[model samples]
Target: MSFGGEAAVIGSRRLFAIHLFTATGAALALLSVLAAWQGDWRATFVWLGIALIVDGIDGPIARRFKVRERLPKWDGAALDFVIDYATYVFIPALVIALGLHLSTLLGAVLGVIVAVTGALYFADTRMKQPDNSFRGFPAVWNMAAFVMFALMPSPAVITIVVIALAALTFLPVNFVHPVRVVRWRPLTLAMLAGWLVASSWFLLTEPPLSAGIKTLLIVTSLYLLCVSGVQQMLPRRPKAGF
Candidate 1:
């Protein structure tokens, strides 16, 4: 091949590698499931956490390398959605069952709700808006459930939160995407960093989250939950083409 063609081939290979990297999250998700099956909660969270990191980084890397532009045949977003459903919805449902020690009947019912709503949300092309914010709750059950795990909230409280969030999935309200949302991005990312650190401490340590870390986590969560609501009420800028 000519030098130019050789360079093009190398670049394509790099893009493919990035796709492979994103696909690894599926493996991690499976590992998480197995870990959870064994009642190895820590290991489960560890795998999910690693998968979370992979999910967070791959998008930027893909965008930076122009993966979509170069590899039009590969549906990176679709691959991501599959893994995301595992880590973000399915596994979290399992965790909710195990973590809360729910009866099998209860767990199955709730899990079905999570999986069904999550699948619908994923298939919704209007899930994300032009501003890079989610059109609804975004179905981040993993984080929602994880926070509940850390806090060890009452089962009733947990059920209420889960049901409420699932309902929010269909709402027209906006939810921020942290890295993707442009408004207050720096501050949002800073809060996200704090949340990751605080949440990591909870995941790494045993149950009975410390007062300080729990407070930090709560603060960050409230910011994430409320910021977009505030933005929703403000007048909209002209929607930009994505």
Candidate 2:
């Protein structure tokens, strides 16, 4: 082969390597499930958080390297979806069901609801709008499970929150895709970072989160919800023609 042909092959191999790196998040997520089964809640969340970080960075890395263009035969997005469902929905649901110590009936019901709603949400093509905002609650059961575990709320409150989040899966309300949405992106990321820190602290420490940390979390959560609400209320202008 000519020099140019050799270079092309090397570049393609590099892109494929990036694809494998992206899939590593799924492997980490699987390890998280094992941690949960071993009754190590801290390890479970730590692994999940690491997986989340991987998922967060891989998208930009893929785009920067143009992995799709380099490896047209492989579907990175589909692979990501598979991993996302496993880590974000399925494992989190399992953690909540087993770790939370809810009644058996309630735990089973919550698990089914989380798993089914998350799967349906993933299958919905219209879940993301042209503006790149999520058209619904976006099946963030991982975050939900984390919050629930940190708060250690009452069983009744847990039931209500779980059911409400599941119901929101089908609603038309727009949830901000922090990385994708242009408006308030910095603020969103800042708040998310704070929340993550608080969550990590709570997860690593003993049962209930500290009062100040808990208050910070609640404020951050409310801020994100309000941002979504405000954005939803604003009329969406027509996009320019291609």
lDDT of 1 by residue, 1-242 (tens): 99999999998897899999999999999999999989987788889889999999999999998888889999998999899999999899888877666777776777788888888898888987988999888888888877887787776787788788888889898899998888888889999999999988987777688889999999999899778878889876677331
Each candidate: how many clashes?
Answer: 0, 0
Model 2 agreement with the true structure over 1-242: per-residue lDDT tens digits: 99999999998888898889889988898789889889987799888888899899988999998888879999999999999999889998897788888998889889889999999999999998877888778888888888888778899999999898888888888888877887767888898888877887786677657799998877876666557757779766566221
lDDT per prediction?
Answer: 0.86, 0.85
| lDDT value, residue 34 of candidate 1 | 92
> Best candidate per lDDT, number?
1
TM-score of each: 0.91, 0.93
157, model 2: CA deviation in Å? 0.9
